[model samples]
Target: MNYTVNQSWKILLPLSHLSPNYLHEHQLFQRQTGKSFLRKIGGGMDKFPISPEILRPTIVFDNEINKVARALGLKGKRMPYETANGTLNVNIHYYFEKYIVLDVVFKQRISFGDISLLQKSRLSSYPEIESLVLAIAGLIVSGNQQSYSPLTSIPTIRCFSIQSLDDNQFSNMELVEALTGHIEPTQRIIDDVLARNSGHQTSGPIITLIDKQGVIQFIPNKPKLTKDALQKYSSCCNLLELMLVIEQSIKDGHLDSNNVFLSALKSLVEKPEDIVKSYTAQRTIKQYSKDFHLESRLSDLTKKIELASSVLISEKKTLRRGWDEFYASNDFFQVLFTALVAGLVTGFGILWAFLKGL
Candidate 1:
C-alpha cells in the first residue's frame, strides 16, 4: 500500500523493449489522439463518439485507476490495443508477475461486441490475462449487455455498467472481488472498507447488491423476524417448546408443508427475535379462536329462541280457536235459561197481588 507514484513515461519505457509501436501508439493515444485514431481504424463499424466534457473526466479517471493499481503493487500503463473486431482503447493495464489485468472504460454505452472483442484480444503465449474489467455507462443505443451471459461464467472478467464516471466510485465488494478473488477474504475486506468509510465499527459482514441504476444497496446479513412471529413466540415458555410445537404442526400437516417455509421456521427458532415473533403470532391465533367460539354460541342461542317463539305463537292461536268454538255451541242453552227465569218472576208477582185483595 505504501508505493510511490511512478511517472507514466517511466512505465511506458519498459514496454518499448516489448512492443515499440504499441508503446509509441499508446503514449500518443493517451495524449488525446486515442479515440479519433481508434474511430478511424474502426472504419464506421465501432461508433464510440467522445465528447470533450467526457474526455477530460475520463482522463482523470484513468489516472486515478493507475494510482490504485500502483497501490496494489502492480505496474500501471494506459494503452490502446488491437482486438479481432477492431482497435479498442485499453485505458489501463496492470502488470503482475504471473498475469496481466486489463481495464477498458467507455464513456458511451458498451456493447456485447466490444466485450467479445476484448475477450478475443487475450494473448495465448506470454502474460496470461488474469482479469478483464470493463466499465461502461450512458445510454445503450445498440446491443443488449444482458445477452452476454457467458461473461458471468468466466470468473476472471468483471463487467460493471455504471451510471456515470464523475465519482470514479466502486462498491467495496467489487474492489474486493477484483483484488482478492476469494469469498471469505473479499467479505473481510468489504467489512474493513465499510467500517473505515463509515467511521463506525460493525459486528458482522455486510452484504451488498448493485441495482440496475448502479446504486449500492446494503442488505443486512441477519434475517429480520416479523412482529406476528414475535407475538406467537411470546406465548411459548421457551425456544425448545416452540420448536416442538412447530415440529408437531409440521407432522400433523396443520402448518403449510412447503419445505422452504418449514426450513425458514426451523432456522428462525435459533434467533431470539424470531422467537418473539412466533409468540406474537400464537397470541393472535388464540384471540381469533376465542372470537370464533363466541360467534358460534351466539348463533346457536338465536336459533333456539326463534324455535321457542314459533311454538308459543302456534299454541296461543289454537287456544283462542277452542274458546270461540265453545261459545258457538252454548248459544241455545243460554237463551232457554233466560226464558225460565223470566216466567218464574211473573208468577210470583200475581200470587202476591191475590193475597193483598183477601
Candidate 2:
C-alpha cells in the first residue's frame, strides 16, 4: 500500500493500473448483478468517493537525494539515480510520472466548527478524492504518447502536488530542488533550444503546475488533456462529451466507462432536491406561462424537459443493454461453454480427416 524510502520525506500513493474499460465494465457489472438473473462483478468507478483537496503525494526526484547522499557520503539511502540526461535517465521517469515540484506546497488546516452528517461526508470525502486523484497522474502518464504511446503526445504541461504537513515546515527544499532538477523539458523547450542552435539537438519545453490542494490528480496543460474535463473514475457531464473523453482515454489505455457510469449515477443521485426542484420548476413554468406567450411556448418547454428526462432514462437503458451484450459475450464460460466444446470436437474431426488423408 505504501513505499517509503525515507521516513521524513516519504510519499503516499495508491496503486492502480487504470486500464481502459475497467471502470465502465465495473459499472455495468454492478448494474447487471443487481438484476434478478445476471451476475455482478462489482460496482463501477463512480462508487469511489470524491474530495475537495486532491493530493497526489509524490516525492521530488530533481532533489536527487540519492546522488546527494552519495556525493556527501550521507548515511541515508535515496532510491535510484534519476538524472534527465544521465545514463540512468531519472528525468524520463519523473516526466512520465508527472511529479509535482514539492518546493512550493504548504498545508494549513481549517477546523470544523461542529460535527454532523454533512460534516462527516464532507470530511471523509477528501481522502477518497485524494486517492482517486493520484490515479490521474498515472492516467495522464499512461496517456502520454511521446513518453511511450503510439496515440498520444508528450503532455505540454503535467501537474501534481506536494503537501507540507504544517506551515513553515517545508524543510525538504534540497529534496525539492533535486526532484525539480529531474523534471523533463517539454517539446516547446526542445524546439526553442533547436531554434537557438539553428536545428541543433536540444531539450523540449515542459510546463509544470503545483497546487496546494494536496490532491494527486496529475492534470496536463495541453489542449487535449485540459479539454478532457473528466472527474476521476467518474463520467463526464455530457454523455457525448464523456464518450469523446473516454475514447481518448481508451486510446491512451485508460478507458473506464464503468467508472464513468457509476459517476453518472452518483451525480444523478446527488440531486435528491432535484425531484423537488423539478416539481417546483414545473409549477413555476405553469404559473408563468398562464399569463403570457402562446401554447407553443408551454408545449416547447414541456417537450424539452421530457426530452431531457427521456434521454437520461434511455441512456441508462442503453448502458444496460450494452452491458447485456458485453457480459454475454465476455462471460463465454458463463454462457454456452458446451457449445464451444462441441465446436472444438467438430473442428478436430475435420482436421483429423485431413491429417489422415495426408
Candidate 3:
C-alpha cells in the first residue's frame, strides 16, 4: 500500500535479506536445466522452465563493483549502472528464468518525522515490490517452452521498490502487484534468435530464456492441462473433455478451445494484450491436422494412379519395340502375297491346257 512504502522497504529485501532465501527454497529450484534433462528425453519432457525468483547480485563497496558481486551470489556477471551528476550509481539486476526482471534499486532518503507508515490503512493485495519479482519469474518459465511441453510460459512483468529514501525518479514509484500478470514495458524486453549450425534450423536451436516479455518462441499455451488430473479422468467428469475441445475446434467451425487457451494464458500474466501476440497454436494444430490428413490421402491416391500409368505405358512400349526388331529382316507379309499370286497363275494355265486337249 502507498501508506507504508514511503518509508520502510529500504531495509526489507537487501539489508534484511528476508525474501531471497525464501525464493531459493521454492521447488522450482529443484528442477533441472534445459540442456541436462532436455537431452535425455529429447523433445519429450514438459518440465517447468521457471527459475526461482531469488536472484541476489553482488553489491559493491569501496568503488569496486566486482568485489560486491562476489560477496552476494553473482560469480561473474557484469553489474548494471548509470552515471548521475558525475557519480556512478550501481544496482543489482536480477533476472529469472520465466517471471521477471528487476533492479534492486538502493536509494538513500532523508528521514522525515516518526512517519513509520499508516498502521490502520488496509493493504492493497497487489504490491509493487512483490510484482516485479513475480513478473521476472514468469518470464523465465515461459521463455524456455520447448522444455515444458504444453505448459505455457508465464509473461514477465516488473515492479520494484527503492532501497533509498531520496525523493528523485524513485519518488512516485507506483504500487503494482501482478508482475508478468500486468503490463509495464520498462521491464519487458526479450533476447531472441539464438542460432546453431548452417543447415537451416526449422524450429530448433533457439535459446530458451524467460525475459520480461510474454512467452516468446511459439504461441503461449493454455492452462486447461492444469485442470485436476482426477477430474479429467473421472467418469463423473467428461473423460473426453480435452478430446471434445480438440474435435470441436476442427469439425464444428468453433474456435472455443483456442479462446479458452488464450483466456487462461492471459490470466496467468498481468498483461491482457500480451495474449494477442501469442500464436494460436491449438487452433493451428487443429487446422493443420485436418490438412495433413487430406494431403496424405491425396498422396496415396496419386501414387496408385502413377503406378498404373507406368505399368500400362511400359507394356505398350515393350510390344512396339519387339515387333520392330523381329520384323527388321524377315518381311513375312511380302513373301505371303507373292506365294498366293504364283499359285493362282499356275492353276489357271493347267486348267486351260486340259480344256484345249479335250
Candidate 4:
C-alpha cells in the first residue's frame, strides 16, 4: 500500500540583531511581538515590560540588493522547491518579533513496505529539505550583507515533526514504528497535563524516545504542540558547520541526491559511530596523503563517484559492496566461481537444445 507522508520541518532562527526598523526596511512585518507580563519567580513577583509598537514598513530596495531579495523567493507567499521524491513548500515567519521561523512542508507518496523503508524515506528526504533550507540561508546571508550587517552565524538546531497524511486512530505500536522504525514501548507523558486541561487532551501524549542523535517524539495526530516539544529536545543539535558545507555545496551545484552529504546522512541514521570513525579515518588519510602520494588518486576516485549520474544513488551502495566483495575474493576462488557459473549456463543451454530435439 502506498501512503502519503507529510513531514513538517520548522527552523526557528533567532535574529537578535534584527529590529522592527530593520524588518520594515526590508518590507517585512513583525508577525509576532512580545507582551508585558508579571510573574512570580523565586518566590517574588516580577514585572517585565515590552514595547508594543508595531512596525509596518514599505521596503525600498536598491538595485544590487534587489537581486538577492528576489532570489529568496519570498513574494508574500510560500515558495515550492521540488525534490526528487517530494515537494517542499517554504514560508518565512517572523515570530515573537525576534526569530525568523521557516515553515517548511515536505509531501511525498511512498509505498508502504518494510518498516525499514519508512526510515529510508525519512532519512533521504532530510538532505533534500536541508539543501533547500541551506539555499535559503545562503540567500538570506547575501541579502543581509547587502541590505544590512551580515548574520553572525547560522542556526544550530533543527525542529522536525512528521506524520502520515491520514486521520486514522494511530496505535502505540504504529507510532513507535513510524517514529523510530522499530517496535518498542511508548509511554504517555502528557496525561497529567491533559487531566488538568481537558482542552489539551485531544492533542495526545508527547511520547519521548531518547535517541543518540536527539530526543525523538511520537506526537499525536493533532500535532498542536509537537513543534514546541521538538524544539525543546532539539536545541542541542548543532548544525552550523553542516549548514555552511551544504550551502557551499549548493553554490557549487553539488546538492544532489547522490552527493556525499546524503550518503553520510543515511549512514548516520543507521551507524552513527561509523560516521565518526570514517571522519577520523579521512582526516588521518588527508594528513598523510602527500607523504603517500595518494592525494590525486583519492580525489579522482571521489570525483568519479560523485559525478556518475548513470546509476541511481540508491543502487550505488549495493554496487560498490558487490565490487568490494568480488575484489576481496581469492584469485583461485574467483576463477573457480567463474567456471562454475559458466558451467551452469552451458548446462542450461545443452538441456534446452536436447529438449528441443526431443
Clashing residue pairs, backbone N/CA/C < 3 A, model 4: none
Q: What are the RMSDs of all candidates, in order? A: 33.5, 22.1, 24.7, 24.2
Full-model lDDT for every candidate: 0.30, 0.28, 0.28, 0.41
Return the top candidate by TM-score. Answer: 4
lDDT of candidate 4 over 1-358, digit per residue (tens): 4444545444545444434333454533332332210110101112112112222212422333334434544332234544556666655544233444454556666555555433533434365455546555444434443345433334422223344434433454544444344444345423322232232122335543322222233444455675654443232111211232333343344434444545543332334344333332223222223222333433444565666754566588889988888778777587878899999999999999999999
Per-residue lDDT, model 1, residue 174, is 51
Alpha carbon deviation, residue 179, candidate 2 (Å): 21
Q: Which stretches of candidate 4 lie over 4 Å from their true place?
A: 16-22, 27-78, 115-124, 145-171, 174-358
- Where model 1 places Cα greater than 4 Å from the true spot, the runs are 1-18, 21-89, 92-103, 106-179, 184-187, 199-358
TM value for model 2: 0.18
- lDDT by residue for model 2 (105-212), tens: 112222223432122222123332222223333443343222322212112111122222223221222222222322344555434332322221111221121111
Measured with C-alpha atoms, the lDDT of residue 55 in candidate 1 is 23
lDDT of 1 by residue, 200-239 (tens): 1122233222111111212221324222222222221121
Count clashes in each candidate, considering only residues at least 3 apart in sequence or on different chains. Answer: 17, 35, 34, 0
As a whole number from 0 to 100, the lDDT of residue 325 in candidate 4 is 84
Top lDDT prediction, candidate number: 4
